[model samples]
Target chain A: AQSVTQLDSHVSVSEGTPVLLRCNYSSSYSPSLFWYVQHPNKGLQLLLKYTSAATLVKGINGFEAEFKKSETSFHLTKPSAHMSDAAEYFCVVRTNTLTSGTYKYIFGTGTRLKVLA
Target chain B: EPEVTQTPSHQVTQMGQEVILRCVPISNHLYFYWYRQILGQKVEFLVSFYNNEISEKSEIFDDQFSVERPDGSNFTLKIRSTKLEDSAMYFCASSGGRGRPDNEQFFGPGTRLTVL
Candidate 1:
């Protein structure tokens, strides 16, 4: 079975400060990792994805995440936080069932980010 | 930019009633999916549709749930009997090209289903 765990339920940071949201995963094989953000009453937007091509993946809104296989972690980071960056973040792991040949996405509990002005 | 669209932003229904959630995937996308999130819970995948059939489904997607592509642009999820536990935010998503690991999935705003 595959699963993802988000270390923090909530994180608060001051504007212009660096932000970090930790995520770890457990999978039997190599997996694809992704970071998604959701604003209040908005859809989940893709921030970045790791497909084994690059250890460090850059995404929209100046967000990026590094996939560290040794640590079993794919943590999201932003150099500076903006007021609009406040939202719920989710870590997702994609895996496939051998028999079905179908993809399954496992999501983490999520981390709510608060940007203080 | 093209994106997925779901109908009925919110739906409230009595227990045991039937509810249909509709989605219009991106015109050029070939793979469509349905996901749900209970209040304060992680988002869970329900099912995936491609080539006019269900390519995959999670354990949560039981016999009570069914999906259909009645038209070229519309994908629908029907719950045979709604339960109180079924209340959640349902999201529709789609991806272009084959349903591969690298294809990015774009999500819709989501439909809030409330079963009273």
Candidate 2:
């Protein structure tokens, strides 16, 4: 089984300040983790993914996440928050098994980011 | 870049009425999926289709729910009889290639279904 837990339900940050949104996961096998952002009335956009290649993954809009194996965490961070960064973010876990021949994504409840100017 | 497109951006139907949501995934993609997000809830996976057949489905995808490719370009999801609880935002997504670990799924804007 695979599951993701976004530690924070809501996060508030001032524009120009650093941002941090924590996520943890539980998977029986090697996991493919992803961070996705959804703007209001928009589709889910992939920010970045960790597929065992790099521990520190950089994504669009100056966002990045570090995959920590020992802690089972993949937390998203940005050097500075922008007003446009306000949106709902989801932490997702994809099962890496090959026998399924299908991709199954397990998503977290989500964290709503509020950027203040 | 190409992206998934969904039709009937918003649909309002009475309870027990049938609803069909349409989607046009990326032209070259092979794996297609359906997911739903109820108001203030986590996004839940419904089903996945490939080769004109269902490859996997979640428990939430009950007998009342069905999916069909119908034609070469469009994928459709049908709810035989919707309940008030069925009102939610339904999103269609597609991923290309051999379903590799790096194959990221592209999503549609989603269709808001309001069951009255």
Candidate 3:
């Protein structure tokens, strides 16, 4: 079974400081990993994805994540935390069905980031 | 920028009542999906639609749940009977991105369903 774990339930950082949200995944095969951000009362927005391509993936709003196969991790990070960056972040892995050859998304519990001034 | 959109920001219904949620995916996208998140829970996949039919569905998408494209633009999910446990925030998403459908899925704002 493929699953994702977001290690931190909540993380706080001062504005202009570095932001780090940790995530780990378990899969039998090479898996596709993604990070999504959800603002309060808003939809989930795609931040970035890794599909056996570049290990260091860059996403919108200066967000980026590095896929580490050895660590089984795809942690999200930003050089500077912005007040508007405060939101819930989810780590997701694609789950493939061998019988149907189709797939569904398996999401993590999510990490809530709070940026303070 | 093209994006997915869903209607009925919120719906309140009694148990056993039927409800329909609507979404309009980005124009030209070929794949559609439905997911729901109960308050304080991880988002769970319900079903995926492609080529005018269901390509994949989770265990939660039982016989009571159904999806349809209806026309060229709208994709809808209908729950035959509602349960208190069914109360959740339902989101609609679309992909088929530029190449890999699994690459990225643009999600709609979501409809908050309340079952009484």
Candidate 4:
């Protein structure tokens, strides 16, 4: 079974300060992990993905996440938080791919980040 | 940067009425999926479609839910009878890789369905 757990339901950070959103996962095998962001009135956008190749993944908008296997964590981080960075973030894990070229993608409950001025 | 698109950003319907949510996946993507998020809840997977047929579906996807790729560019999800519980934000996504590890699915802006 594969599951995603976002540690914080809501996180508030001061403007220009560092941001950290924690996520953990349980999977039977090495899985593909991703971080996605959904701004108000917008679609879900991929922030970063961790494949087998790299453990530290960089995403758009200066966001990044490092996959730590021993800790079972893929925490999202940004050096400086901007006002526009406020959004709902989701941590996702992809299970084994089926023969039909698809796999089950499990999503976390999400963390709503609030950038405080 | 090709992206997925969905129609009717918001929809309102009476209970028991049928509603069709439309999506146009990326032209090159081979798989399509539907997911929904109730207000303040996590997004749940509804179904995944490939080769014009459903490859996988979650328990929430009962008989009332059906997915179709009527044409090369369009995929649609039809709810036979809308229920008040069906009110949520529905998103469509597509991926281009063939069962590869890095094939990330691109999502649409989503359709907010308000079933009354």
Candidate 5:
């Protein structure tokens, strides 16, 4: 089984300040990880994905995450926080086998980000 | 820029009533998925559909739940009898293929079902 744990349930950042949200995952094998953002009353928007090809992944809106195998972590970060960045973020793990035909994804509890202007 | 679309942004139903949530996935996608998030909880996968049949399903997808691709574009999840615990935001998602590195899923806004 695969699972992800987000360290923070809520994080607050001031506008123009750095932002960070921590996540750690457990998988028996190499895994595919992703970060998604959901705004109020809206659907999930893919921020970035780590497909094992890259250790550092860059996402839209100036957000990025580094996949550290030693730490078993994939933490999302932003150079500078924007007021519009306030939303809920989720870290996901895919439990698909290398030779399987089906795929299932597990999502984290989610971290709510608040940006103060 | 194609994306998934779901119908009935919100639905309120009485207990034991049947409810069907509809979605239209991307035109060329071959994999469809249904997931739900209870209030203040993480998103949980319900089922996955491929080739007009169920490819995978979770324990939560019991006998009361069924899925159908009635038409070429429509994917529907039907709950025969609703329970208070069933009330949540259901999201439909689709991917172009299975297990591909770039086969990222696109999601719909979701339908909020309230079982009263």
Candidate 6:
């Protein structure tokens, strides 16, 4: 069984400050990690993904996450927080070897980001 | 920018009534999925479909739920009996890869199901 844990249920950051949302994952094998953002009452949109090729992955809207094997973590970060960055962030894990292509994607509970101006 | 599209932005149904949520995935995507989120709750995986058949399903996807790709473009999820617990925002997503990083699943705006 694979699972993901988000360190923060909510994170508050002032504009122009660094933002971090922590996530840890447990998987039997090397995993595919992803960061998704959902605006209020909206569908989730991909922020970035780590597929083993790059440990430091950059995503849309200036968001990025670093995959640390030793820490078993993939934490989302942005150098400067913007009002648009305020949304619910989800850390997702998926097994690369799962027979069922769709069975492996597991979502973390979520971390709501609040960007204060 | 191709995107997954879903119908019935909102649906209201009585308990025991049947309901269907529809989606049209990106034209080139091969895998499709269904997930739901109760108010203020995490999104739960319901089922995954590929190659015209169900490839994976979660415990929540019991006999009451079924998925069908009636045509080349449309994927549909049907709930046999509506329950108050089933009320939530149901999302449809699609991807183009078999596994790993290339398989980015794009999601639809979702249909808000309200069961009375």
What TM-score against the true fold does each predicted structure earn? 0.95, 0.97, 0.95, 0.97, 0.97, 0.95
Residue-level lDDT of model 4, residues A9-111, one tens digit each, is 9999999999999999998889889999999989899999997778999999999999999999999999999999999999999877565567767999999
Per-candidate clash tally: 0, 0, 0, 0, 0, 0
Weakest ten-residue segment in model 4 chain B by summed lDDT: B95-104
Q: At residue A105, give the lDDT of candidate 2.
A: 86
Per-candidate interface DockQ score = 0.67, 0.71, 0.67, 0.65, 0.66, 0.64
Off by over 4 Å in 6: A101-103, B97-102
Write down the worst ten-residue block by lDDT for model 5 chain A.
A96-105
CAPRI verdict (incorrect, acceptable, medium, high) for model 5: medium
Among all candidates shown, the one with the greatest lDDT: 2
What C-alpha lDDT do the candidate models reach, one value each? 0.91, 0.93, 0.93, 0.92, 0.93, 0.90
DockQ of 6: 0.64
Model 4 quality (TM-score): 0.97
Model 5, runs deviating above 4 Å: A98-100, B98-102
Q: For candidate 2, lDDT tens digit of each residue in A33-110?
A: 999999999989999999889899999999999999899999999999999999999999987655557887889999
Q: Summarize candidate 1's per-residue lDDT along A1-117 as a digit string, tens digits.
A: 889999999999999999999999998888889999999998899999998898999999999999999999999999999999999999999875645445667899999999999
lDDT of 2 by residue, B15-79 (tens): 99999999999998888999999999999999988888998898999999999998988999999
Encode model 4's per-residue lDDT on B1-116: one tens digit a residue.
78899999999999999999999999888888999999999999999888888988999999999999987899999999999999999999998665452378899999999998
Candidate 4, position A13, lDDT: 100
lDDT score, candidate 3, position A69: 95
Off by over 4 Å in 1: B99-102
Scored against the true structure, residue A56 in model 4 reaches a CA lDDT of 92
lDDT of 6 by residue, B1-116 (tens): 99999999999999999999999999888889999999888888888898889988889999999999998999999999999999999999988754432477899999999999
